[model samples]
Structure formats: C-alpha cells, structure tokens
Target chain A: MTESQFPQCRVVPLRMLKPETSERYLNEVVKVEGIRRMMVNGPSIPAVVPYGPARGSPNPNSNRRTIKVGDATMELRVQVGSITFEVEDAGVIEEIRKVTNAFFTQFPAQVLEGKFMKTEASLVDYCRYGPNADPSVIGLVDPRRKEAPVIIQGRK
Target chain B: MAYTPQYGPGTSIVAENRRKQMNPNYKLEKVRDVTDEDVVLILGHRAPGSAYPTAHPPLAEQQEPDCPIRKIVKPTEGAKAGDRVRYIQFADSMFNAPSQPYQRTYMEMYRFRGIDPGTLSGRQIVECRERDLEQYAKMLIETEVFDPALVSCRGATVHGHSLRLAEDGMMFDMLQRCVLKDGVVKYVKDQIGEPLDREVSVGKPMDDAWVKAHSTIFHSLAGVAFRDDKEYVEYIQRIHALRTKYGFMPKEE
Candidate 1:
C-alpha cells in the first residue's frame, strides 16, 4: 500500500489519567460529529486481579464499565489510555481539539498529533483473524494473545 | 580518611539529577503537601487512626539472641512496635519523569535503612516497617522525586511507565486509580486500584518544563540520549569491557 493509503488518521491522543475521566472523555468525543472512526488505546483491564494478595479475584474496577460511543454501546476492555480520532479529513481535528481543550484545560491533558495506529494488517492479524478480517479491527487486535479473550460487558 | 562518594557515572542533566537525589546531604525539595490522611488512603494498607497490624510480638517481648550484631544495630521504631512490613510502589514515566525505577532504588538504598526495595522496568517497590514505610512514603510523595502526573502510586497495574503520556501529562493507569481534577490529581482508588471512601488529593502534576528539567531518565524522545553523553557512554563501555575481559580472570596480567 502507498503512504497515503497507510494510517491517514490525524491522531489527537486525549490521554486521561483516570478511567472515569477517560470514560467521560470517550463519551464526549464520540458525540462530536467530526470525521471517521475513533478508538481508544491503553493498557488492558485484566479479567482477574493479576497480582498481590488479592490475586486471581475478579478485577472489579468501576472505570472498566461499558461506555456509550455514539450509537454503539461498547464495554471498555482497557482503561481508556488515549483516544485516537481518524477524521474524514484534517478539518475536524480543530473542532475535536476545541471540545477536548474545554474539558482537559483544568488538568494536564495534552493534544499530541501523529499516526497512532497501523492501517494495514500484520502477521498476528493473519494468524488470529485471517485475511478477510476488517482493517480497523487489525489495529485493535492484541499483539500478544492469539487465542480468544473473553469480552465481558458488565464487570463480574 | 574522608573520601568523596560518587553518585552514578554520567555528564547529562539526568546524571546530575541522579546525584542530587542519591546524595543524602542534598535535601529533596517539597513538591506538594498531600495530607497524611490522604497518603494513608492512597496506600490502602490501613484505615486512618487505626492501629498498625503486627507480624510478630514487639522486640521487647521477644527473647534476645546473644548476637552482638543485634546490639550494635538498633531496631527501628516499627520493628520495636512489631509493625507489619508494608510496601509503596512508584511507576515513573519514561518521558522524562523526575525519577525512574533504578534511580529510585539507588536513592532509597543510600538514604533509607532496614528496607527492601524491588526494581522493575517501570515500577520500584520499597518494603519497610509500616510506620517507617509511611514516613518514607511521605517524603517520596511530597518531595521532587514524585510528580503526581508522572509518578504513579501503582501496586498492581503498573503498565504505563513507558507508554506515551496522556494529554494531561499523567501516566497511563489501566486501573485508573487517580483522577486529575480542577487542578489537582486525586486518588479515587488506592494504589492497587481499590476504590477509596473519600477522594485523596495528591496535588497537581508539575508543569511540563519542571518535569523535564528535573527528570533523571535519559531518553532521546524527551531528554538527552545516553549516546549523546560521551562520558556516560565511555563509563558504560569501560564497565562492560572490564566485566567481560576480567570476568574470566581477576587480573589481565
């Protein structure tokens, strides 16, 4: 694929410190009618308490709850680390920035510009989901795990 | 004989910052005043005003082994009180945060005693007597070594050190333990990401300029790279050469 066909997303990484803040940010950003697809990337919210004395217990992080993104109701698998917006064009980047700045202005949130995700499928994508899988989903695939991960909508 | 002690070998600002922290004589500047109660809440070890849970009977109650080493080394207050060993972990952002795991370990080893410190890629955990941990934790939290946005109070889900910082200059926490409010970063949950009863304000993160200026980590992205520091690179080369060459035999001759 040519460089233009490569990841064209003008990434406005809205990195929030807290999951609730991130969840709120996600809810607001998705509502802004700007351009193309938007996805948040961050460290995964583990299914179990990964370590310490409470290891193996169900991770009941409140911020790991499902959030409304436009019309779609999606469970946030990871604490929304940073939100990447794939605008239809560069025009909406400024609009999204205005909405984000109003919210993140009090705190230390930044507006970083770049191509955050891969537009093309990788070896892992082929190994896990196959060739016909959506390009958007390719970037979302967990690079580490090939096996199916249980996606729980509600915290157990 | 009085001999000058060297902090790590480096010529960069990162190296200078390391020396400032490692030297006990150099007082760490206060960054914020997170109340003692707020600190306890964030730690999630015990409740405010609660008695410290003990692991064993007080030192006074235990029979002394006639070892002279015991007499020479005075027991810490927490040990005397039989306080449980508790730990506080910090994950410093790699994007030029004031301190990182190795630097943190080096500083703690020099300044504190009767402690056990564990260093990982992004996080550093120090285990000490409960009361002592609290004291050390306070110093660590209040001092320049910590920036609420850059250094996370993470015990379990400490995955965001190397990750790109969020818009607000806060480290990425999957658990979302802390929130950046009006101007302060508050702990909505404990270090391990357990929900707290009340919000514990850790204080606002340092501005970008301050965080960058005080950071000890050498990263090409934000701060000076290790390759650029000729003396540091030479020191590393010298150490590696000596270890490989003389490891087979103590003396080259």
Candidate 2:
C-alpha cells in the first residue's frame, strides 16, 4: 500500500530541559486520541563512559535511561530533543498541542506541520534484507543507530 | 614603530569582555573565593599536600645544555621542578556563558605561560605542568570567567554546553557532579564525576544580568547577535581578505 495525506505527521519541537519532563510529556501525548506513531530526535547517549579515567565503565547518568509512555516502555537512547508525532488527521494536532502545553511545564513545544517521519524504507532495505523487509520499521527505528540505515525489517 | 598590543575587536559587551580577559595587564576581577586545596581536589590529579610528581629530573639536578635559546628563555616554576604535564578542562554553556572555549584559550595564551590549550566546540582544555595547572585552575575558578550555572569543569561527558539549562539555571551534568542545594552550588564529585570524600562549594552562580553583560559568545537568541556588531563583522572580513590574498600569492602588496 502507498502512503497518503490522510495519515500525516506534525513534528512538535519540544525543548524539554530534562529526561523526566520528556517522559511525562511522552506518557501524556501517547494517551491523546488519533495518534499513530512517535519518534524523538536528539544527541545519542553512549552506553558506557566514552572517555577519560572511567573509560568502558558503566555510565551512571540518571538523565539517560528507559522511559514509560502509556502502555509501552522504551529505552531513551537520546535526550528527547524533539518529538515528532504521526497522526491520523489534522484534528489530532490540537490535542497534541494541549497535551504538550500541559506536560512541558518548563520549555514548551513549538508545533510544526511537516513530513518529518519517513513514510517508506529506502534502497538499502531491499539490498540488505532481500525485499521481504517490514515497511512498518521504516519510521519506527532510531535514525542514529549504527544498523539503522542498513536494515528496514524488524526480523532477520 | 612603537609597540602596541590589541585584544579582539567589537563594540558589543561580549567583545569588550573578550578584550578584557585577553589583556594580560587588565586585572581579572575575582568573583568567588576558592582555596588552593579546593582547586587540587577538583583537579583530581594529586593529593592536596602530596609532593609534586616529576616526569624528569629537576632542571638544576640535570646538566644544562648551553644553547643560546635555552639560556635566554627562563623555565617556569613547574618546569624547573620537572613536574608532569596535567590538564584542566572547562565546558561553557552557550546561553550567555561568560567565558567560551576560544575566549578562554585567547585569555590563557595572553596571560599564562608554558601551556598548550586545545579549543573545541564547547569545551577548552589547557595542559601544563601539574603545579602550574593547579595554580591556573584556581585563578580560572575564582575569576569572573567561571559561572557554576553556565560553566562546567568537565574532563569527560561534557555535553551540557549547548543544552538548555536546568530550572535553577545550572548546566546539565549527566554525571550530576555538582548540585545546587540550599542556594549554593557544591561539587560532590571530581571533574570526571568520581565521588569525593567531602563536598566542595563552588559558590552561587552569577545572575542573568551578570552573564549577559560578560558573555563572549554573540548568541542571537540571547539578544547579542554577531550581525549587530558592524566593526566585528568588518574586522572578520578584513582578516579573511588578507589571509586569502596572502595565501594565493606572497608579496608586500
């Protein structure tokens, strides 16, 4: 099936100063009606201490961790710099704005309507995974991951 | 021609600050009081009262090579003592932080001696002999160059320079090395976020007014735009023109 204007996305540029606020905002936004999918963009947090005396040591950074969003839980790889929301219709935009305003107490979101999320997987998806790749994984996967641009399929 | 020294150019307060910090003769106003021991503890190199660890034999003990340049150039205290080279790094917030990476390097080049400073996007690291670095770190901490909220002494994981500040105006430290509690900022850990035996107070962060008045970076969002300063723009253009002209062909004209 091809992508359509009916399933549009509006990227809400959230300037959440902390991970706690991002978690709260995400949890609230997921509860809003007409929401289809979500993805966050920001600087990637390294799994271990990348440099200095504690090289290779487990990072004790409290800000970088897993967060709960409604029923689903996900590990926050990046500091939730901005949240892009895929919605069913333009009507859901107002609900997103309301929820963003309520949860983002410190730094609010500046909602911008655009095609921020990828609708389909690229040529790498066909060559690497041999054309049986899942189309749903196109926008769901983290863009910053090492194997991100390589694969489109959720399964081997 | 008579000798004259010039700092940076600009009519803005940020440029003025850059000039002030770079001018060796101009006295840096001490904003806070940090003891020598506190500096040592924060550096995490050697114990407060420990003997200076040397990389080589002291200059006096070692036979001096009678080179003309060596005779003319005087060795610093640390160099004479043959202390190992150590470093102190700082990350300045983009939100009107008083001292930026390049600004800090320019200031250090003008003021300090026997040093190697590496300037990056957000952080600046100055390497020097252990004793010299300790002394320099103390001055940097005590002066207006440092603001606990807008600046961080991070050896690693220095990511908060470009990030939005915390609610209380403190720069985000993933390690949580420093905490603002009871209206004062205290370091509970070393520069690399290793737990310290006792808390070291870095004092209160400067207010918005102070930071705005002293910021070296011309952040358009923060009200001071690089385009606003005509003289600064012209200076940059002139420098670029001259560099290109000289690079393509070398002549007096």
Compare the candidates by lDDT and give the number of the best one.
Answer: 2
Docking class of 1: acceptable
Which candidate tops DockQ? 2
Q: Per-residue lDDT of B15-36 in model 1, one digit per residue for the tens?
A: 8899999999999999789777
Residue-by-residue lDDT tens digits, candidate 2, B1-253 = 9977778789988889999999999999999999988888888888889999999999999999789999988999999999999999999989999899999999999999999999999899999999899989999999999998888899888888888666567776666678787988988778986767888999998888898998889999974999999999999999999999888887666
Candidate 1 runs further than 4 Å off? A1-40, A46-75, A79-156, B247-253
Q: Say what the interface RMSD of candidate 1 is.
A: 3.7
Q: How far off is residue B175 in model 2, in Å?
A: 3.9
**Considering only N, C-alpha and C atoms within 3 Å, which residue pairs clash in candidate 2?**
none
Q: Write the per-residue lDDT of candidate 1 for residues A1-70, one digit (tens) a residue.
A: 1133322343234443455676566666655654455666667887677776557756655557766544
Tally clashing residue pairs in candidate 2. 0
Clash number for each model? 5, 0
